[model samples]
Target: MSSQYRTGSRGSAKAKVIALVGAGALLLTGCTAEAKRGWLPNVERDTTNHTGAIQDLWVHSWIAVIIIGVMTWGLMLWCVVAYRRRKTDTGYPRQLSYNLPLEIFYTAIPLVLVLVFFSFNNTVEKSINAPVDSEVVVDVRAKQWSWDFNYNYEGQKKYFAGEQAHLNTDGSAGVEETLPTLYLPAGKSVTLELNSRDVIHSFWVPAFLQKLDMIPGKTNYIYLTPQVEGTYAGKCAELCGEYHSEMLFNVEVVNDAEFKAQLAKMEDGHIGEEYDRQPNKVNSVVVEHGHEEGGK
Candidate 1:
């Protein structure tokens, strides 16, 4: 009878523990409702055509991370407290060696997690990389410490070019210098063909949440549709040479009329002759001493 009573007590303890764990899990699940409502903080703000979809994936992934973390820590704490070496414990605990089911479970869960993440990420990546029927095609050239943006408009057999950002003459990097502006029409898709004159560089605009590497011999393409209308700063994300930090540029998202106006101004500027020259088959312009010459 005493043995039966001890077994019942053990069963009761297990039931109590399971009930507590379930309650805690339910509480956590309730908290995750906030995540469903989009309460995650670390996610970047959605400003472009791609940022919203990216944020959705980011939030969901973080939600999974939080749940896994809570459950893992909860189990660890329960084990530490429930199996601690108490003074009343006389001999060693059970001599059990291994738990095959637990091991298989741990292994299987990570595999399943990786598969799910890969699947979702693959879908999003494909969506983002899909071809764009662009209304504007811009040629981007990255050199040692600067960037040049060129736009080829319809019916204009020439390409309009914008210069690189120059550092302030005051010797104080504290003051912001005038950076070349990349003008884009709002709600229009634009395709950029990127190339590098020297080393590798990354074109990154934080608001766009998209970046592409510029290779010296290869031309890369990036498509983006800006949803918001504003001026955003851009820079080279890659660590190039000594003045890499000064490779700053600005992107101006404006109305269609304004974009055309900017293009017209670029074509009528003093360097319009240089802009009229087209690059040969390579679609890359030549640069000497930070000045862009006609394409080879």
Candidate 2:
């Protein structure tokens, strides 16, 4: 009996050592490997006007989550190995009914964690939705499965209305999937007023790290700044209708001179009367251009 007890104890100790070594290796691998490639592995890469601030909050949140996850998993593994049934056990191990201190610790810790997370999220949300002195305002209208972007420049109503792009009829792929391009000056604040014509739709610019819903009879606002000088993709994030997949758009961030030139060109009888202006109203006309009343 003494020999059997000694042998069983030795085996259990060896098993525990192996488990600890494996757990340590996993922790080291996860930390070093993911750290090399930015800590938050699942978040979208940010390139919007004020997305840097949001990105900071996002990274910190993920770090907190990972730390809690590791600790919780470590405790579970430790409990499994440390209090496991042994082959050399006689009748039963000493079992405690309950510990008030441990119970309170578990309950209180989670509550504190929840509050901390909530506060962090609230701060980030406020920062994202904060108002800014906008240099330009674009009224965005969603209908069926398409987006209409009306740009108001220098106190003038939409001098140019942007809609979905069309491919050349020659069957050649010239600029594949290029949709309505909304031009804005980089490093300037721009406000977008979102309104839906018929059904609900979402305006999402993944690079901007911003999205807002457009509901009928209600106007939603999205304020953002574009910092990059390239075209970024935008899309209707919500499934609205049969052609929902075709609801795609583009955002072109340009320099101040180029932005002004584009607006000037649009005002100089370039867009023509067919692409004429419209009143900026939340509950106004929702007809596509040329399909309007008595429009050619």
Best by lDDT: 1
**Compared with the true structure, what per-residue lDDT tens digits does model 2 show for residues 158-251?**
5444444444577443544456667888888899888776677899877676788887678889888777788877888998877676667777
lDDT tens per residue, model 1, 124-210: 888988988788888777766666666866744234443444566875553234676677888888888887766788998866767
For each candidate, how many residue pairs have backbone atoms clashing (under 3 Å)?
0, 1
Each candidate structure's TM-score, on Cα atoms with residue i matched to residue i, is 0.72, 0.72
TM-score of 1: 0.72
Model 2 residue runs over 4 Å out of place are 1-46, 92-97, 159-178, 265-289, 292-296
Q: Which stretches of candidate 1 lie over 4 Å from their true place?
A: 1-46, 90-92, 157-177, 268-296
For all candidates in order, the CA lDDT equals: 0.73, 0.71
Per-residue error (Å), model 2, residue 113: 1.3
